[model samples]
Target: MSTPQEEQARRNAAVLQAIGAQQPAQPEWPAQPQPPQEGDLWVPPLGPAAIDPTATAEEGAGKLSLAFWVLPDAVFGMILALALQVIALFGFMAAQGLKTQEDIQSLQFDPTFTLIAAPTLGIGFATMAVMRIRLLRKLPWSWFGLHLRTIGPALGWGTVAGFAFLAINFASGLIFERLGSTPDQAEQIIGPFRSASSLQLGLLGLFIVVVGPFLEELFFRGYVLRAIRQRLGATWGIVLSGALFAAPHALSITTGFIGLLAPIFIGGLILGYVYQRTGNLWSCVLAHSINNLVGFLGLLAALSLP
Candidate 1:
């Protein structure tokens, strides 16, 4: 009769085989038949962690410990992106005239800013993100929660989520106004688009709805959120990533800076949660684009009135 130790060895050997790993043809087994007690598991020490849904916290923690380089990769890539953006912004300001305080204030209102913002930042971020994945992640698109197989549902559900979040975002803006934020704030965003020619509007739409969302989602949810999630558990990963998503605007130490931060932070949390649940970056990107589109349209409409 086969001893319990030998039987356990054979079972572990079978599992290793199923996962494309090799084991000794006849693995050495303990002489004594130390049969496991009831409710005990026969874990394989030589293999990677099992994918059991009921895995212990220790196993889960070990799994989360992987991808330690993810956040560092994100930070490095973001620095490169910011540097490129700053250089481009300086060039644009020089070309379009930037001599006074008023000129700097009016930069965001410039149509040229809208045109160039996406391409420069998008290219820088995308290039770094891909390179980091190739050199460090050594994983497929699925690791970033972005795979072609999930494209259809990702886009569809993402678009729907976008509209829903847009409504909530608009409501939040109204609450801000009630708390003394002026509706006049809309002009800063709408100024460039209000008088845009048809071609300019089209290009703006193409960038905002497509390029901007795709790149941001890929960087934020795919790269940043994934890295954090691998380091922390799901909830902290989502929350911290969402906070990081809004960290740029919140750098200013003014109350109004908070006003800018709040809405984006809320949106980021929801998007991060969605990415966690769905494991598809496309959905988050589509939803973000929808939010941007509706917000822009509403601002432009407000401009048309009165």
Candidate 2:
């Protein structure tokens, strides 16, 4: 006859064994007991049950989707921009008979600039337009990361990135001069801003340095890069995005093919990486705008010096 304490110990051991809380070889064994079949029966263990449908659906939908935002805008803008590039390239071929840098520079028309700026603006607007109707009214502006939240970091990164690019271009020019080769043509690209009237310089600077960066970042980093990352995966996406970025700079014959392509490629990679790390367009825009402003200011200062 077991004492009351011994019986209580036996019951506790049985529950522990049923729940797999005791080692199989341990001597604290109790017979496996079935529930008295009066109402609900104890179910033996099986592996974990499948997750609920609602939980599975929520998990699937939780991630940030770049594909949903970037593809259509890029495809539309690319088609339009490519056509303009072809026309611009043809004009360059036709104008090749012109002599000296000044004559070559004179052929650049406002329409070409219009053609270039229009498609980028169109795509950016299109993306924002879609997002506004569908998801959130503030989606486009939010995509640009226009919060008072990150303004400090954005400005700091922008200044650093701008200085870095200026240094690279300066170093490249020195290297070329050392090799007795023509320095990069981007050195001359912003020369117009140096001689323009103050008002003209302000307008041009506003358009080129500020507006241009906003539009390009909105399209390239916010739209094109995101789209490519979705369709092609990150590595190829980065390469293609950078190449596409380089293509527009081909409009300037001064940089020629190689010189123009190099910086644009580097810029694209940097901007893309910035977007990847920050998950926002503000940093890229800051980096790009700062680079442009530095280039503009450097050229102006050079022109002013005796």
Candidate 3:
């Protein structure tokens, strides 16, 4: 008789065979590999899984490059500015029956069109820039330095900074005037607004105190400055971005009054520094708005004087 161990082994083999008979037969072709399930450690094929050295750094880092940020900003900004100017021109023509180039030129100073056009341009450009940043970079709005937590402090600081900047500007202007230079072209540009109807003046005031500052801060301090800071170091970034911010306004600088560039550049630096420190776009916006408000109030006071 077989030993107990031998019998047990035979019985186990038979039982396994019986169970195997109940199962389906194996396929002729090599069995297809099973898909990896949870808890599986899958190793991709060596060649196919290799990382590409040529892949874009920005894509790898999941952020836009400086070029991507600036190009769309400039192109869309110019387009929007041009489009708004054209629309304003058409609106002015419809209202005033303007036909000749001279008529349009003369009416360019109309407060209603000027006030409406300026804010519309700024808002449109800012909206485009924000949208580009969102869609292309897939970034959150807060990436543009918009935050509510610091808004109150930002506004308070902004107010103080605005007043200080105004004081400096005033002192500089007085010194320049004493040096036998004529008034800045900005004065000429603003002179007509002083004579605008109360309604136009009110609209202009709203634009200056609210829309203008918000849009400018969003574009300059929020978008441009942030992109620059990401690429260059903070110091050069702030300086370059501030210089860019001052460029367009430089066009308004009078021939003999190049000193005006200093104030605009200085203002840009202050706004940029505030944005950099607080990481709050609204802080800069509020500061700029307060500055504009002060100027607006001063204009009104001057106009009211006999």
lDDT of candidate 1 over 96-153, digit per residue (tens):
7788888877776677675776466556556666666645446566666778766787
lDDT of 3: 0.70
How do the residues 61-109 of candidate 2 rate in per-residue lDDT, one tens digit apiece? 2254444545455556656556665665556546565556676456443
Candidate 1 vs candidate 2: which has greater TM-score? 1
Write down the TM-score of every candidate.
0.67, 0.57, 0.72
For model 1, the stretches where C-alpha displacement exceeds 4 angstroms are: 1-75, 89-109, 150-153, 182-185, 250-255, 303-306
Q: Model 2 Cα displacement at 63 (Å)?
A: 17
Give the alpha carbon lDDT tens digit for every residue of 1-306 in model 3: 999999998888789898875445676998777886998745444321222111222222344465356656756786888888788889878887989898877765667767766666576658776776676566677777777977878777777778777876787677767776644565655756757888888887888788788887788877777776656545665787778676666545465444676676788888888877777788788888878888788778877766
| Residue-pair clashes, model 1 | 0
Candidate 1, residue 185: Cα displacement in angstroms equals 6.1
- Residue runs of model 3 more than 4 Å from their true location after superposition: 1-64, 180-186, 253-257
The order of the candidates by lDDT, greatest first, is 3, 1, 2
Higher-ranked by lDDT: 2 or 3:
3
